[model samples]
Target chain A: MKKRTLISVPVIAALVAGVLFAQDITTWIKKTAGDKPALAVPDFRGAGDAQPLMAVFNATLYQDLSNSGLFEMKPKSTYPLNNPQQQGDIRPQDGKGLALADWASPPVNATHLVFGFATITNGVFAVYGNVDDTRQQTVQAAQLLSNRYLGSPVEADAIRKAHEFANDIIVKFGGSASLLDSHIYFTSSRGGAGGFGTEIWVMDWDGNNQKQLTHLGAQLAHLAISPDGSRLAFTSWPLAGGQPQIGMVNAETGRKIPFYNQQASLNSAATFTPDGMKLFYSSSASGTPQIYTSALDGQGFTRITSTRGNPTEPKVNPKNPNALLFVDGNPKEQIYRMNSEGSGMERVTNGEGEASNPAWHPDGQHFAYAWTRGYQAGEFNVFVADIAEPQKYEQLTHDGRNENPVWAPDGRYLAYMHTPLKSRNAQIYTMRADGKEIKPLTTQGINRYPVWGVK
Target chain B: MTSEFFRNRNLTLTATLLVAALFSGACGKKAPIPPPPAAPTATNTTPSSTNNTGTPGRPTATLTVAPARIERGGSVTLTWMTTNANDVSIDKGIGTVGSSGSQTLRPTDTITYTLTANGTNGSATATATVTIISPPPPVTPAVTRPNPMGTLESRLASDLKDAFFDYDSVNIRDDAHTVLVGNAAALRQIFMDFPNATVNVEGHCDERGSAEYNLGLGDRRASAARDVLVQLGVPEAKMKTISYGKERPQCTEATEACYQQNRRAHVSAGQ
Candidate 1:
């Protein structure tokens, strides 16, 4: 009996430890740490000879959800064996075919299931997607992504289809209000040797279709995409040793327009008002770098912020045209806000680190910014914080010199510049709000100041 | 025996649970970091990595100004040289320079210069100062046209002291009154010396405000500095004012010492 007791004690203790370890993983993504809604994307069924094309579509779709920052993708090992092909597979638990909620919710614990089909007709590639609620067993959104003339590369078409569908699912979740396509503008100096000046570049929001936009031949600093997304605003010297001034570029025609008054102001960090009617910037024409706004034609100038230590990166509140957001610090900086008339000054961040470059979400209640630990050797990371509550800041990046964060119009993602610590070579990247699903948008050169826009 | 056995099991289990809980909480990072994309990617477009040699060597530096004295607003050629140095910088914001080079500088007042060359083995520094001499009483094109410098330059063999202001404020300092008195007398003399020549009272600021706002602040400071000269019997027609907000720094160090030197109104002779 003594020996048996000894054996049972060891056996029971070991079993308890094993169970606890597994439990820890099960709750790893649970509600306290903020549980993510489980989403599943099954293999895209396609017509004969569509396997390779389907593989592209499948991989793209999977990658999108995993990085979306909102979804807890059900691991592939837990997925049902067979792919659901036709309408019969989708049930009306809430009334028509097989009850999908029952099938999807049980084994996979999927709150949302994304299943789609594809076809190649007359050399044109077409794809469709559907988002079904597991509990309600009802179709939330269904859309045909594309019907295009397949060029030589079928894989390219598949990528477009996946991007469109992912955007559709985002809408189903009541996220981004912007259209299906998006891009981020950044500055890079990758084209030349070390001393060569940086130029402006743009790439797809999901990190593809990269292209250079401007070749200033001189150093470029910061940039902004116009509200309509057809134009871009940037700062660079026209000549090698000239002063940096604001310049505009047409996204489509690629016509570079230096401000009519090229020497109008020593300007940098330009942003357009939500209506795109007026543009705001920091100018030293008056001696000190204060915030100013002018009509799109560069008239009707209004001085916005007059605080000391320079107010830079003036962002007009999308929800409140009269409100403004900016950064102030001669040495150590913090984010601040005031009215259009430069009244009611209020500090938005406190306690630690110099916070600069505040990017407002669509809601206008919260903002994201880059913070440096101090004026020492510490690097920078991106943080998202509420304007109403200063202390409740969420760190969105762990380690890296991430700066100049801009929000996607949909409010679901943030795009910013990421540089390895102590490195001058920077790249543009996008990540979901939860800091998950990080995807690089630009792979080359010293990139900085990325802004998401429709163009 | 039953009670003892239960106690032992419970203690063991509790300790195991504590260890597991700590392990779970230790994760402040994402798990299963994906491998980086294969080398030689299509776009290795990173620019300006600045692959520093990181090795240090004994450094030596030399700084000089051509004809180290000049009429106000006149230009001077500045030449600097260094040996066995990794980095070189001139005191007033002419940042990290080459081993040897020349820059044409226009200083409104006397400027003290300092050049520092840094290397791993050690660092070396050298300084040279430039003096702005008022031109021989400007040959007055018209006695009545009202120039601001000729007669004044004669009375003040010494350089006219520039009036300084507080940070972000355009109010002239009390200490600058004596300097303004001499500057005013010089401008009055210029009216008799060189009528067509304009004395531009340029405002400047510490590199504190937005470059744009600093321009406005500098203008205010220059305007304020001009106020003293105007009150001291100098004609407005003889003086014009502008602001170079925070752009032209008298010192480039990121400290109060340098910033204080930058916030002042400078008198540059301009058309």
Candidate 2:
């Protein structure tokens, strides 16, 4: 009976340990663009046997905050020896535990500190998070946020909870819409070799959860997701050796959506309006592949460009519905912009090397594109420029064949296809708007044409 | 003794359940979960099982067409499966595809589709035929008449010469001019032979530039050829223009000769 009681005592204690409770609270911090608050994020402590999940959660949360581009993260080496695990741990202590002064002082100089702990019991995963203003004089004044997140004991949910917390922090810092939950739709030739093997695939913004979206068994290009994320548009050949046509599919269900087939061939490069009520694409139905607009169901088709050369890749301004941009050339291609009504035409790119794949920045006045910039061997690099100030442009990449630049929802980052000098296949890569901290999101197969989905 | 026995069984059961939960909870993939049955079909089970034996065998492929014979405009499903293969593809505009899957295709003419499977060991190919049966012609005197479309296309292909272009240039060269002049004479004769037939001018490009930009360049090459033929007295209404870009190259080599061969405008009988 004595041995049995010893065993039962631990069993009951373990069962009781699984039961945890915490208060849910939110704190909003309004910040200006110039503040660029310095932040320190300590690894969240794990309370149970949840090392695997805690690793993922901690890494994901750190990555999200770094990618936000709204804060200057302090290095971990300068962090204090004592790290906090809960709201009460953010106390004014000095010897062994976390002290707000350690963060506010010189070497660290963190304007704010994000500390938290996570636990897994039975199958439930919970995260107790806190954000404190290190500049405050008192503990209560320093405490800026306290959040409790609960979800399933899986890596996916762990990632989601981290994203939610990071988004809350980003919004509190006055950042634009977050892209943590959005997806990047692109084309990959992993399905096969050559052009016809290309198919459309989508992945999380951070390059997780890659899934195929189309299996048309044809050469697919120029992927454009609708503003609402419910529909996808691309160029594909309906018949063998026939002209290309615009194809639409239900982005969620993968069901074929009806699109009008024009008489002439060479229909390609489909994009959407800000409202997503209509589509703008390049079609040769009348003559050259010029810009044309049609309703979502392919009705009320109207020609928007009468240029003599092939004008394709029409990207409508996200903020201004009446402003349009496209790529056109007879032999040498260049980026051009015009009013959505086909008036006030202006060339947006100057200098050497062909410019193609123009994508609009969220600010509407600025845009991103790929250009040769006097480079030889057909190597192209990405550049960002103001539509109104064509002479004032910044080249983001110096080497490698970087093209197809698409702006993230936050307008602080750009995701494009990059083919390293040694590699034969292109992979998806993302970097800050200033062309810093370039990170590759895909390593397998030939991926191209990454378009960020609206969240 | 009975209470002791019950407690022991319950504790053992609880331990087993806990272990099971941990194993299942490890599946934390955020990607959409593929249905259970689909996993086996997508992967070749035989090769994977043979992996335990320390050696892999050559890949084998089988391709079949359902309803092998069909009327014109009718579609047929082409199904293919491969084992011990890393890459599988079907020829005739259907490039690389999955190891095991089916695609519905409409063939305007009889075509023999070939599926190729390649593995680290070797490669194998399987062929399936799709025969297009034409509708019976309106009964107007029982005469042994040859297929008009096939004969016309063959004649046009032999008489009409392809015009080549310079690197990244759509301007009609002197050699291309001489070729178009001869093609113009042949087109006049073919139009007279088959009054209802039309010609399709296809523009092609070498594999030196971006696929999207090459598409536009190919369009200009085809249009340039069509304009030259029009100047040589060919009717514009009877000709249609399209661009294949670098997608359908006549040669896959990286040499200059192969690239030159791919950059051309060829006139073919339109469907």
Candidate 3:
């Protein structure tokens, strides 16, 4: 009887502990799954294809997932995937008919999957996609989208919708739904405002909310955002006689204040320090665009770099507060890293391609910059390189003239301005950090000089 | 032994029941206690007064005037008045008007206009406008501008163009001194041929310095050149200097050729 009583007590305690552990596990699972997953969709379709309509649907879906920032997106492969005659057609109709057993393995491990279809009916293009829950073996959601074809059959609008669809899929799956709502501030010269006059403009990350920040008459360039995203530092030359002055304007208040006023021609590519207490700029005030530093209050001016050649575009490393990365000009235009006081200059890349506009990742371990093979017209593209091992540089964009790569705060993606060789206008494009999943973040106007907001 | 066992079991049961009851009671009564009421307070009993005079509830009899805006050479009249006027006197812009209740005054150039009105309830002050028209333009000094040196003066021009100064320094070096000596000799001959002509020395710098510093450096370079000419027997007042700094560059490229052309001093003549 004594033995039985002792054993009964132990059994009761074990039962209570088991119940508590089960509850804890349930809570952990709920907490882990509470936030939406991030999705990355780099590129939807190329410029021209036989199935242009379907290409648009794929592009839109990819952009939608990317903008949603939920679900890790696989890099898009441009193989023969959509043709009906192909062995594996992943369009919605066929995707809906797929059996659970068919997708239980390798590439289809994703519990939720999206399939897109495009068709030109009576010369009017329409695209649609379906998201399926493979575990449930059911079509979770379907969207039918239409795109306008205004004479030109380039199908930019169709591709844009496909990007939107991917974002909608993540939203429907209970992900953080505000991913597509963010805006990108960039420089644009659309509307025949000729003579290298680029105005600051903002647009939705997925290319919808287009608005100009500066007046059409102002000559704006070299835009930088404060680490807090409360103010913007840029170079603006007034229409009247004066040098290009460094101007700081409240991002929300639109109150402009001059950061540096000098009579010499000042073309300042200004950037805020990580602590937001100082700014680094390249100015001819010292007789060339050598790097200079000043307090945020615009005092305590100091010449940080005295290199023989022009040193412009100073990008402070986000991870290491004491280090700075900048473009050392002439002959090579290669990216260099140095201390904040401009000592211990080290060359980071030795590629034949001239690299400029070095933008540091939030971690500062890696950076994205623009590279061109000399003065070739259509050879510019964005590349990423690890600072620790400077020799390892990876190309990010393969399209025409992509330059000025700025990283998103999360270090997962980059926003860059690209000017296609065929089109005179420049637009903003975004891609994953691994040089995959490229997509246009802006469609209207000539957008350039993109600076991602601090996270 | 049986009695002791019964007693121990009864005590253990009672203690367990007591703890369970306490926990239940605490959990069931989890609501916060209500706060105590605040005490009532008294209100003010004073009556309010009204008037345009200096009564407690009335606004003061102060006159206000907008600030005046006038062009550099233009003039404007300012006027002010008070309803209960005893004695009016203009405090500022006195020559234009002295009476305060109501007055019109005009002045050339910018002037501050103030007026005071004395009343039974004390004197009230009002400000008036004083407009001054355009000020005199900056005086254009009588400086000599030299004619463009011909091809015969190529060696002098080349020597002058190659003379680069140290950062921010304008003191003529031995090389620059020798070059300027030759140039001054050539300039003297040119001035003799054109007796009524005056020479203007323009100074410039390379593109590597700050704008203001460059401007000052250019000025110093021109001053150095002017002193050389004066020492060479040209009249001290005949040689005028202007510094263009890095602006108005002869070449806009970043190459050595362009930079060499940028750092120089030139002589221009005016007939």
Candidate 4:
């Protein structure tokens, strides 16, 4: 028998290079995929008379994705689709056609698409959606789910799951993800036990994992966390018929200590300075939520701001100690900023709309705030603007009512509370800084006051 | 040949018998058996029990060392022993005990005491009997008490009813000095009964100034009061001073009426 030895150097090198190239391609795909322009949903056909269940489903899905931080969704408009007449003029054959020109127009960048269909079949509400790749001309994903819409509380659970389904599709289509892991601290009054009994509660940003933080049945509000996330400050109404006081609690230890005591109102939006040496808050101890500064040791308290209208929600700029932003009134509250020593007070937003609950982005150059436009008629939305150029404001949401905007650590996403009148329930939502690809992040109870964790 | 052969056979027989005897001895030897102990007798009492003699059948008596009471700030020695105790310990209240088993304690006030003892059987305890004979109260000197400064004098008069002071000066004013002189005489009489009493002079301020500044002002008021007593022949060591700067208000209003009632100084006695 003859033994033969064979060697092929070029073949081995070619194989090795192919493997390396494949890995590089995969990495590039993941990176560039995130940079792709987010798909826009221009219209909800036949949505003018959308049943209550369809509104609930669409609102929940929008809120869940917006809170997820995965996609940059355009704010949903409540106006009946601008061209409802055009929908009826199209023939059956036209329904199957791609309205490419319409989809590619302003405010409708056709990178990806989502369309929903809801019908009442056999006394049950059936809802489904088709997520399309307008660029690829194909249906990328589809979902068909039904709920009995029984006029009970259980319907909220079904709606929540449907919202989750929509969020999963967004994730699959390479969009920014939802904030299902985040929790919010809000006040609630569900059990009908009387009084201004505001209890602090925490639930998944997607409206699950609901838990109560306070059970004293006191009117607790104005919750803020320290920059280090080690403590929480809030004001509690009178307990045991005693004076109201400003209170602080160790977030980890749950140990509560009162910082201010007064016979009159004594609580406001109390936040810690970056160094945690001083606290900035509003108090009505002297009447009205006037901004006050005090040492963390509860000494050297000085009123920094005094105005005819109450100054509330003082959020310190992360990059600048001498700067602060807050809302100044009700009936027509407006956003304002001032120096730490109360000098250089200037109005940031015009009095066109009632803007409140201002939150500064971590970058210190931008802020997100809830503006109540046509509030009397129940039309409100959130807006974001760059503080460096306050005149350049961007409207971020147009759903029934969106408020309480909080910025994530990366400044790449925002979480806010959205309430749809159809469901009469509030949920959390997230969207990109550009106000595109908005989606729901929570689906249970009335979730509000979302605070992003320091990363 | 016959003789040699017989000798050889005898040698072999002797060797075999010796081998058998050695093997048997090896197999027969066993561990030694212990000797039985002698029974206990009533005369062999434990050394601890023999030495202990407080009360037969009663555990050794323990003495508890009470905390020391200082006489004019001098130390006091305390000692305790248990009868028939193998080990005795004195619960030395505030002071450390010496190797000689005695402790010298210097305390601000009279204290109780306790001690513990242990024997072969168990432990016991005892408490020291305490008789608190309080010292006589210190004499208040005949000097006039200092008047509160600024708004303090009038505030003290209104709040305390019995106390008063002059304006802008801590010196005891003539009119207020007369009142203090009378109180001093009564205090002197009381001191004769209790010679070792001490007094604490507390000063306060109105809410017209910063806290730190008011604290210093209050201290001055208290010190002035103390100096008057000292000059009047009261021992300096018998008086101490404290200041409360605008912290405790007599009235809760921001009006002058409330401010006037908030400033004052008073003396309290301790024995």
Candidate 5:
């Protein structure tokens, strides 16, 4: 353990040495189906007290890259013996650790390799990571990207460093807006009596550091994180027990921000505009719950829907502010889309069980919702449909009651609530957008209404 | 004159049979315990007797309280006695009691305790009043508006009947029509009593279906009930509707009956 003084300077530094690539890295090539470039991530080397911190960093980095939906990760069992422990170990010598040929050819035929080292100096943590293009023919020319991240010697900061490193890797691969630092806001009934009362909560993208955001000992529903990630809007029943009203709270401070208690008896399912300056919610002020939009200050409140029946759950398209998706009922509660001004209404779901909790993919052309076609009890499953071809939809879930499918900021993953058959508690789960790699994000309490927050 | 004569004779025959039935109840004992002395001729008093048919006599209960009047918060002893009764209960929060027992109670307000005795033959009840001198003011003052009926809103919650819906349908059921009609009449009376008393219609659902969708369904159910009430002459402006979805259920059992009870629009007073 060679100790060094804790560095107080800025953590970010550009690669100062000769770091060059043979190919243009900015313009990402659109790989065809089943043509993902394989990448291998090895456990980083560490010693002494840094070993535990390295474990957290290493696991977080691997999981982040694996869940990126951008590449195929080579299995760890196939890695070569004697992985490089430091920057000096990767020389073109015959017996040196990390021979390029070992990873570039044969058993571990990974086109790209990511290796890193973690060390604690004077109670401060610093991680050095590098991504290499193993097919560059020479070991010296194989280096693609290199960076150093420093943080406090704590598990949370270690996780943060790993996310930062993963984000760098994802950016090099030409992915837009990495989700490594995003937060997910959800409603948890863990604090209520008999699990009936729910409040807002938030956690990291990987479901770490879960925290309760609201102490209101009342039921909350339909949470929506603002586009700017400054405030959270949700449906809350009055503490004295009345109709549900749309409420907003500061995302960082958990302080109540005033939103108008509309003249309606019920106001709920609030979503923020893409600009984060206004909101769209369903209010029954006109005898039927209709889609309405109001400024954050509760001014310019306008009812946007006049359907004689119930129309609720208004979600605005991130790319096209004029377009909105909502649930409307006359025959059954089904997904419907229309202009923001409430014209050109067209039904998006037909025939069978109900559809609800419609969410927009970041691309704006595709949407995901919980639908139960040809109904049965608890038959609701997540389905993704393209607006261009709504009839040819992909069902992502097979069994259980899955609802509230909110897409990750990058549109590559989804978070929802799932209750398996015979299970009484509903838990929050996240999976790839294609419905693969299902992982439960919560297990301690009945959690639902997951809204992915963007920074 | 003949009809009156026959009626009097019928009354006499009934009294004779009642005495005979009471005696028969005691005949089962081998070493027969003598019947108690004749009880006072009060509404809740019945003498222990026997009849030849060997059936239990009607149950009788006599409830009395020591220190019938006391200062606020003072305690009193309430004693009840029952004959030929297997089940005896004292109302006013003193639930079940022995067939005959006494309980010390501290009531904040003036209250009447009723003792009910149930036996094989029939049931009897006796009540005792305990007056509290200078009762303390209520913790929450009665809600007062500009109307004559100060607490009419809370009262209307009980007077107005709730309308139940089907499993997932928002259509007012056939039976709900009768309930809404009665509720509408009650609402009319309350409106005449206090024009400021508004009604709040709440829609609830069974613990099935998605919570978000159920919210909309519940709202639809509430609006449906409000629409019916409006049609029945409940001023639309005087009423509002909200939906609790499956959040606030009246019954938590996982049965159809409980579900039916939960799937309802409860009409109550609004703030």
Candidate 6:
């Protein structure tokens, strides 16, 4: 809401007064784990032909970094003495602006400096990105060789590539790595039958380049993408009035197959194990939905959680394979961990509304889930909690009814289903793990069950 | 909202897939409900179906299925409606259903599912078919694909009765025994007719409970029915059990009757 960026002109007198202003505006230590790292994103300077994209790259890179919610970027107004292009002496690999730390450290208040040069040669458009870690005094922070374009529309998205550099910088400072070109797999009712039922959709982290993966033309009960991002397992009544069963659709091909069809039973939440060799699915073949692990080929079936309530949504920890998390107990709080063998059960999150839809951040120690106050109908908000200490948690979204917060691979961002207080239509929304910079991916028609992964 | 349309406009060519689907029979099996050309676009015709038709407080019933003739063990959408009815029940173990809704039914044999809707105007009855048409002869090394010209000499999921159970318990009820007796007869007929045929018994529960544990509870219900069916002379080797827990509910309503209907054991063709 803070108008994405700040840009204002100064008169001669204003400039004279500003010229005398000098303070350590950059290298501020990050006080909290969720604190946004102070960063400076200068224009991705380019030669003559590429000058057309200077503004585009600048605004795009600035917005992308700003949208990441990991940086407190210094505006262009404060960037006069810190030009990376002025001397060409600051190599992108040497993480330098004006080829000197003193130029970017204090007055700009940037703990990290993200500067780059954009160039277009013959038919290729490219950006040379650099980062300056002033504290480490590391000359070569990190460089993204190429995230360029070849043909028409053909202008380089230098800033788009720079997002990777910014994310790398964020990760280096102990933050989640997102905005570096990750994809979000969500449900959308875009071009389905009569534009009717919701279909699984894929899009870039910024909600761009969205495409339909499966024209299910049916309501999706639960969705999980294979670890490799090649297949999608969904629950829905493909036949009118038919029972919900597990169905698989090729992620790239969108070819749907009734994967594990247990006739007349509900095969709701089906997920693939991290190794992609086994699929953890909740089958009601035994009257109650118990967690079952099966080979990807649907053989060698074994039961994991055979306890009290129906254990649905068995998510194997992304970091630790032996540790698993699912919504269990009679009341259904998430954060319940068990060995991959489904023993040594421990309840992590309790008395925090109805916790459901737990997804582990790449770090097995931390996870994000949805908490509803009373019943399943109550307004739900997303929260991130540690497995070691479930009580220690951070509530994420509050603007709407948010549920099923799933973590992206980088762990800095999550995608969830959000239905505003006034509307019945639920849209897919992705936000930073800390819950800032909430962005809705689909603008129309009942999108739900979003899972973020990569191919 | 094809993400590819934004990534590369060329991939938008898949948009014509729906057109190709219309001319091809295989696509029909893929997409059961292909919308008409003038289907609603701006605002979806609300999914919540209401019966404003028939006698205002009386009971009216409408039962229909798309593609009534399906391959053996294939699926069919059985949509049924009832208006101003205090009670709506369906035979074939669907039990108490919503006043108006649709279900995807995989009937192996040709069967007519009976619905009874009762209101102040007394009761109304309707029936829908889950028919299994002849499929193509089985080819060696069965390919995992929907066979457009597939034919079969047998049907399995629909012919048998679904055994109903109680809440939070997998114990079969006295009334359910009657249904189980009939289900045993059906299973016996299938076994006698086709020696290789095996039954996949599915356990289901109402939505009132947690989505996780209900799976085991559902399995208990299905296994309970399997035990009774086996005792009634159906071979135990022919039965395979699984649970859906509370994930799939026949009647999604938060009511006693709906829960009663959801808590049951369903018998169908097995994998």
Best by DockQ: 5
Residue by residue across A1-455, what tens digits does model 3's lDDT show? 01111223333453355444433322322332334342222223222342745555554566456444446554434222332221133333443324432342344344444554444555555444555444553333322222222222346666555545654564466543233434567777753254545667776655566776666355566789988877888766443223456778876555676565443434467899998879998765665456788888567778887765556788887756777888764334567777777766766668465667788877655677777744452246787665655565666677537777887654556788776666645678887565656788776666767887642
Worst 10 residues of 5 chain A by lDDT: A9-18
**Distance from true position, residue B237, model 1, in Å?**
15
Model 5, position A376: C-alpha lDDT score: 71
DockQ agreement of candidate 4 with the native complex? 0.00
Please write out the lDDT profile of model 5 over residues A1-455, one tens digit for every residue: 11112211221111111122211111111220113568888899776788888888899899888877777899988888778765566766543237766777767888988997888999889899998887887766888888999899899999899999989988788666778778898889877544468888889878888998888787888898888889998888865568888888999877899888678777888889999888888887877777889998566789888885568888888988877888876656788777787766767776467787889888776788888875574368998876555665777788847888998887778899887555557788998776777899898877888999875
- Put down candidate 4 lDDT per residue, A1-455, tens digits, no spaces: 11111113432343355344433322332342245445444333322233555555666766655444455575444111332122223222222234433443445554545554555544444444555544443222212222222222234643664565665665675544344443455555432134435556655544456666666556554567777656667755442222235677765444675575433323456777877778887655564447788887456778777675556678888877877887764234578777777766667787775676788877566688877655532245777766655565667677637777787554656777676767645566766665755767556554545666441
Ranked candidates (DockQ, high to low):
5, 2, 6, 1, 3, 4
Name the docking class for model 5: acceptable
Docking quality level of the chain pair in candidate 6: incorrect
Residues A1-455, candidate 6: write the lDDT tens digits: 11102212322232244334422111111122246666777777777677786786677667866766667777767654546642245543333345445444556666666666767787567666666564544444423222332332233455555555556556666665454656777766666454235578888877778887777677565778887777888776543334467778887788875464543355767888888777888776665566788877556777776665656778987766766787764544445666677766656677555677788877665677777645353356787765555665677776537877887776666788887656656788888666777888888776777877775
Clash pairs, model 2 backbone: none
Error of 3 at A418 (Å): 2.3
For A349-433, candidate 2 gives per-residue lDDT tens digits of: 7736688888888867568888888686356888877655556567889894798899888777889989866665779999877
Off by over 4 Å in 6: A1-37, A86-107, A133-153, A156-159, A164-179, A192-196, A262-264, A329-335, A373-377, B1-271
Write down the C-alpha DockQ for each prediction. 0.03, 0.21, 0.01, 0.00, 0.32, 0.14
Error of 2 at B133 (Å): 51
lDDT of each: 0.65, 0.77, 0.56, 0.53, 0.77, 0.64
In angstroms, the error of model 4 at A347 is: 0.8
lDDT per residue for candidate 2 within B1-271, as digits (tens), equals 9999879757754553443334334544342232233211222111211122334455666577766888899988787767557999889999999987889999999998888888887776777888889987878887887676457779877888889999878889999999999999999888888889898899999866666667777887898999999999999889988888877789876578998999999998787
- The candidates, ranked best first by TM-score, are 5, 2, 6, 1, 3, 4
Which candidate number has the best TM-score?
5
Q: For candidate 2, give the lDDT of residue A176.
A: 83
Task: Write candidate 5's Cα lDDT for B7-99 as tens digits.
Answer: 975775466456544554456544223234323211223323323455666666667776678788798777777766888898887999997
Question: For residues A10-122, could you state the per-residue lDDT of candidate 1 as single tens digits?
Answer: 33443355344433221221221234667867788778656578888889778876666557788776776654554446645532224565445557777766776777777
- lDDT score of model 6? 0.64
